[model samples]
Target: MTMQLLLTLLLAVARVKASTLLASHYSGQLYTLSLSSTNQLSISGSISSGNRMPAWLDLDSASRTLYIPDEVQWGQPLLKSFTVGTDGAVVPKEQIQTSGGDLHSTLYGGPNGKGYIALAQYDASAISTYPLPLTGAGQPLQKLTFTMPQPGPVPSRQNKPHPHSVFTDPSGQNLLSADLGADLIRVFRVGTNGTLAECSPAKSGAGDGPRHGAFWTRGNSTLLFTVNELSNSITAWSVLYQPGGCISLLKRQTTSTFPPGKSAPPGSKAAEVRVKDNFVYATNRFDRSFGAQEDSIATFSIHAASGNVTFVETTSAHSFFPRTFSINAAGTLVAIGGQTSANVAIVERNVTTGRLGRLLASLKVGNPGAANQEDGLSAVVWNE
Candidate 1:
C-alpha cells in the first residue's frame, strides 16, 4: 500500500477508540449514548435492567462488568451483574441478594486481579463487601458487613443512617462512604482479606447532609469534594493518611451551589458533584413548586494548593432535575441527565477557564415505562 493510504487508514482506526457514554434510568434501562460530529446524541443500543430502579451506574473496565443495585422491593434488595461487551452492549449475568435495600455499589481493584465489590445500603444503613469473581456467573459471597451510624441535625432526612454512596480510595487500601443523614464522611480501612474496619470520620457542617463525593490528589495531599443535598452546597475536605494506612478528613471549605445573592428556591437540593482538571461541577435541582426555578449546574475553580473552591458561574442545564452528569475523558464535553425532563443534554467545557459554554445538544430519551412524557433519567457514566 502507498504510504499516504497507510497513514489515512491508521487515523481512521484511532478515531474508533473514542469513548462512549452510558446512561441509566429510573425506567429500568441502560442506553449506550454517543455524541456525533453534528453535536447530536444517538442511542446506539440499550439493555433492560429489569423493573428495578438502577439509580446508580458504574463500569468496571478491568473486569468488563457493570454493577447495579436492585432495590425494586423493600426487604429484598439485590446486587445485579452484567457483562459489558466491546461494542458497549451489556448482557445480564447474575443477581445476588445483598445485606440491605437502596444500595449503591463500586468495585475495589485489589491485589493480584482479585478484589471486592462494595455496596452501601441507604435504607438499611449498612455497608456490605463481597468477593468479585471473574467468571460473572455464580452468586457473590459476602465477606463483611458494617452498620453505619447516624448523627443528625436535619430531622426530615436525618432520622436514620443513610449511606448514599461507596467509593474505593486510590490507594486501594481504604473505603469512603458518604452518609447523607449523618453529616459525616466515614472512613474505613480495607483489610487484606477484604473486611472493613472503622476509622475517624471527616465531619461536615450540621444540616449539610453530605451526599456523593469525588476525590482528587496532588502530591501528598488528597481532597474529597462532596455535594450537600439539604444545604444546596458543596464541601471540600483534605484527607490525612495515618501511619497504619487509615485516614481522616478535615473540612476545608464549603460553597453554595447556586449563584451569589440568588437564594435557592424552597425544596432545592444539590445532586451529583464531579471533579475534572482543576474544577468541580455540581447540579442544583428544585421541586416544581417553585414557579420560576433555577435548575442548573454550578461550576467552581479549585485551588490546587489548598483544595479551596471558588464559585465561577452557573450554567442552565437546559432541563429540570439534572440528577447526574459525566465528563468525557477528553475533558472537552459533558453529558447531563435531566431526571424530570427525561432528556439528556451535552455542553462544551472551557479547559482554560473551567466555565461551560452554551448547550450544544439536547434530546429526549423518553420515560421508562409509558410512551408519554415524564422525566426518569437517573445516572450517567462515561466509558473511555
Candidate 2:
C-alpha cells in the first residue's frame, strides 16, 4: 500500500476505537462529543432542525446514522435522520412528517436480520414501525394503535394509553414497550417481516407508571427491570420463554428507587434506567423548585444469581432534572444530561469497585428555556 493509503487506514482504526457520546437537546439540536483516552470530553459537531425540537435519539453504529423524533408540541411532528461523519459531525439526511402525533421514543432493532425503527407516540397512543435503510425517511410500514382499556390510579396522567419507550428483547424474539399512561409493559412477537403480533402485556401495580426498562440475562434466566415514574420505584421481572416461542414476564422483586429511610421530594419522577454488569444506574426528574434536594441519580447493586437489585446509594447529579445518562463503551465514564439545568455532567466510574467518583466536568449544552419550557437536554447516548 502507498504511504497515504496506510496512513488513512490507521486513522480510520483510531476513530473507530474512540468512544462517542451523543446528546439530544430539546432546542432542536443534537451534539456529538467524544471521551479521550484520558477521559476528557470535547465537542465534535452538531446538527439542528430549526425549531422542530428533537426528543429521543437512537444511533445505529453499523450504519453510522442517528434517528430522532421531532416533538414539536405546537407544530407538526416528524421523524428525522442524520449521517454521522468521520469527525463525529451529524449531517441532515432526510425527514418525514408523522402527521399530528407527537413521538416520544424510538429504538432501532429487529429479529430476523431486518433493520427497523420502532416508534412510540404518547399523544396518539400508537406504536409504529418504519423499515430502515434509514437512509431516507418516509411513511411507516405498519402501525398498531391502542386505547386505555381501564383508567390507571392516577387519573391526571393515566387517562389514556401513553407509550413512552420501545425496545426489542435481547433474545431478539420479542418487542417490549413501556406504557406510562396505561401502567402496562406491552409485548409483541417479532415476525420475520418486521410485523408485530399481540402477546401478553405485563401488568404492573396501579399507580406504577412504567417509563423505561433495561434487560439482561443472568445465569439461566433473562431479567427485565423498569423504572416507575409515578411510584418512584423499580420493578424486576423474570422473562420466561414459553412453548412455540411465546414469552412471559413474571414479577420477581419490587424496590424503591430512593435510598433507605429516605423519601423522594414532591414532584420527583423517575426518568431512565441502565445496567452495566453488577451495577445499575437510573436518573430522576424533579421540579426545579425542589432545587438540589431532588436532583439525583440512584444506584443499585444487582445480585448476580437472583436477578434482584438492592439500592446502593444516591449520587448528586451536580445539576437539576437529570433526564438521561449513558455509560461509555469502555465502561469508565458516565455522562449525565440535565434537562432543567441545561448542562452535561461527567463522572468517572470505578469498574472494580462499582462506585462512581466525584464529578469531573460539566458542559453547557443549549439555551436555557423558561421554567415551563423543555428546551434543554432530552437524551444521552454512548457508542464506540
TM-score on alpha carbons, each prediction: 0.87, 0.89
Cα lDDT for residue 196, candidate 2: 82
Question: Best-fitting candidate, measured by lDDT?
Answer: 2
lDDT per residue (tens digit) for residues 299-368 in model 2: 8888887778888887777677788888865566788888877778888776655677788777778765
Residue 246 local lDDT, model 1: 94
Native-to-model Cα distance after best TM-score fit, residue 227 in candidate 2, in Å? 0.5
Instruction: Kindly provide the TM-score of model 1 when superposed on the true structure, using C-alpha atoms.
Output: 0.87
Candidate 1 Cα lDDT to native: 0.75
RMSD of 2: 6.0
Model 1 deviation from native, Cα RMSD in Å? 5.3
Off by over 4 Å in 2: 1-19, 36-40, 100-114, 134-137, 287-294, 370-372
Off by over 4 Å in 1: 1-19, 112-114, 134-151, 287-294, 368-375
The candidate that wins on TM-score is 2
